[model samples]
Target: EPEVTQTPSHQVTQMGQEVILRCVPISNHLYFYWYRQILGQKVEFLVSFYNNEISEKSEIFDDQFSVERPDGSNFTLKIRSTKLEDSAMYFCASTGLRGLRNSPLHFGNGTRLTVT
Candidate 1:
């Protein structure tokens, strides 16, 4: 089974800078999602995408955050002017033919962003 792959397992950046996290989701999956977990906290949903458009997003996904599928094989998350609180483990996940609730979701190891 092909799994999601994320780049740069760890990233360190200063506050008020822009960052882009990358992911290559399973080629055959129909749904993709972005989630983030602050250190020692529960995972929070960021955004969901399907058919090349955003399907849902959370309040945390404010103007500073955006998600896109620039190509069929890649999905990305951009955080503009990142703040200290933005530091977290960002994860990329995808599910098979069936929707999320009905199918198993596969997740990448995650990109740990550290904004100082």
Candidate 2:
């Protein structure tokens, strides 16, 4: 089956360094989204992108955050200025437009971002 893949399963950075988390979404899928979970918090939606523009974004996607489809298979999230609060497991998900009763989103294992 097709699956999303994330790189650098774990990353460590200083409080203000920039970091780019990379993901390879499942091919043939259209909708793309990013969500994060702080160590013990609930998963929070960051943003969703489609057709070359943002379809939806939550308050969590502040000015410091940005998403780009740098290439056909690559979806990346860039944090211009990392903060301690940014430490979390970033998950990349993709889904096809079908099954409203089960809008299941396939998620990558996730990239754990650690800021000190």
lDDT by residue for model 1 over 4-102, one digit each (tens)? Answer: 999989999999999999999998898999999999999999999989899999999899998889988999999999999999999999986765688
Q: What total of clashing residue pairs does each candidate reach?
A: 0, 0
- The Cα error of candidate 1 at residue 60, in Å, is 0.5
lDDT of each: 0.93, 0.93
lDDT of 1: 0.93
Top model number, TM-score: 1
Which residue pairs in candidate 1 collide? none
- After TM-score superposition, the amount by which residue 67's alpha carbon in candidate 2 deviates from its true location, in angstroms, is 0.1
- Candidate 2 lDDT (Cα, whole model)? 0.93
